[model samples]
Target chain A: MHWKEDSAEEGDLLRNALAGCEKAWADLFRMHYHRVYAFAFRSGLSAEDAEDAAQEVFVKAARYLETFKGDSAFKNWLYGIAHHAVMDLLRKRGRREVLLERLHENDTTSKCSAAAKHTEVGDVLGQLPDDLRMAVVLIYYEGKTHKEASKIMDCAETTVSWRIYIAKKRLRKLLEKRG
Target chain B: MKDDPIEKYLVKLEVPTPQQEAVERALHRSTLAFKNRVEPKITQRENTVFKWFEKYYLAVAFAIVFAAFASFFPWAERVCPAASETSDLLAIYSEVKMLFQNNLVAVLLQGSELKVQLGVPRNVAGARVMFVEFSRGDEKIKVLCLEGSALRVPLQGKVQPVLEAMPTADGGVILMGDSFVWSRAMPQTINGYNISARLL
Candidate 1:
């Protein structure tokens, strides 16, 4: 169901969720699952890794439900969680040089057609700064407008636009450097 | 050959579409994960006071009124006492949360969030009636003010000592202090209209 934080507020949700409403928590999960999952995938996770990361995001969301302010859209909150989960995954995959080289290869693949794009683009998405990568994914890949992207990003529209611009510039520079 | 291969190359590059299906699956799985991680607590008929009614109501009100005149300072729940019957409390909580989500009260009140916990009736040695504690997030002021008088909640179940509440409007705040400061005008519903309470 659509989330109306005012219905129970963040504090109440936490209290009730803490009380163990499997259904309510489930509803909460459905509300922002996709936003977070795509965030993890676009941030450079494999399909499998993205799935795992999504789980991690929810675990954290459940644990920290009490603190959630609902001040921003739930999408932004989930994305924030996804950002951390992806970062954790990236750090765990500490073969930076090897990974970078693979991503570079993948970058080359994106240069071609969209095929093999999954393995290739997925790797580099995590390589960009969380702020920039999120904007790029939300805008170009996810097909969200700057305003909607801003709602999800919980930042000003200008910030979303700037991130998109900078990410494109950076990706272009990286691709060019690879060549 | 005609133009810079770099700019020419860059212009034609295409960013791949994320698997919307992956997002969908992730959402579903995420919901499950949330449910799994949410280890539900067993609720019992608790008999603690909500923050609105405290024994020190006189001092609290004095302080609050004094503060309102001065700084308008206000204060606080009994600790989170779960319902005695684990299974029953969980059912009640689910129902209450659902009702709260669908209620018109939410739309009317902006930033008016509900805090719910299960309580047992006061003065009942072991009443099975479950009191669904509902309060607004903005009642911090009243809590601080009425910290003295333990407000009698309308719900039948025994009250728990502490229930985590936010700072909202008069969303039916109950005092958990030792004393009380409320007189029942009539039997009215607290935050969760599905539940009924006796105002003391």
Candidate 2:
């Protein structure tokens, strides 16, 4: 209920912000800062970098309010921005290097997944390949209907079904391997 | 895959440490903060993909712009343009086109006429941002609350008499006989089958 209200309010704030309403920008800040922050953190940036990236995301978002599209929900749209900002930050570090790091990064799988639905999971879930990872994130963590996930992923429901099958098997395998 | 029991036990976690409420509140605060600073164009897990670009932003931007310009010149199209153009080569061009092409939504600038805007902007944010107005036609009924491009959110209800939208600068679009310029689209935000009108 709160999230729905919060998003709806954020929608209004975004609308107001575009119209140059004074409180609107403040309201936007109050609403999405930490989600952006957590998003940055979960994407593999250090705390300081996450903070900087979060700030970067908002700054860009505010500057481009004129381009806001109500197409997807406001929140999904914003995630797209934060995703870019985080990517930009990491890209600044270089793609080959980042991938090499991920390929070689020490395991942190022991960390329990966040109880909070939207935290690092956004990063982790998105971290996976479109097939195995996306399904795991949506079904296992996000608790979305496979049907809904299929819509977002633009895959056939059966593909989602198969992906989820492989994803869970892989996840359990990963967890056991990690343990 | 359907009968897989592990799917049942996968585990459903809440948003965070406190409650979904606390995390939501924190996220909301973060959104406000983030928006106060910079409002970027697109945010998606693909953003991480962009991080790969940042390392070579200038190079990438240069490559993209150069490529766009090259592609736009219809140079390759003029050449061999036939069936054997080059498989991998054309594929790259298609991928590049997708970047700037469909992101736009349509706007009817004048009566019985329309324009395709390249980007989404404040002028049309939260308005219908789709080719077919993603929602049903339920939002066009009794509430006519906009003047030119300005919105009266508080007074938004059912649109009566089916008010017409004016041409405005927004995300940016390509109109007939018009060169590239940033312009806004009308508020047809939720282009659903049933959205004849909207609440806000």
Q: Which numbered prediction scores highest in lDDT against the true structure?
A: 1
Which parts of model 2 have CA positions greater than 4 angstroms off? A1-8, A87-165, B1-200
Cα error, residue B78 of model 1, in Å, equals 51
Two-chain complex of model 1, DockQ on C-alpha atoms against the true structure: 0.11
What TM-score, over all chains together, does every model reach?
Answer: 0.37, 0.37
Candidate 1 segments exceeding 4 Å error: A1-20, A95-115, A119-131, A142-163, A174-179, B1-200
lDDT of 1 by residue, A48-142 (tens): 56667877888778766645555655555666677677777866765354356445656564532553544445444545776787777776655
DockQ of each: 0.11, 0.09
Please give the TM-score of chain B in predicted model 1: 0.16
List RMSD in Å for every model shown.
Answer: 24.8, 26.5
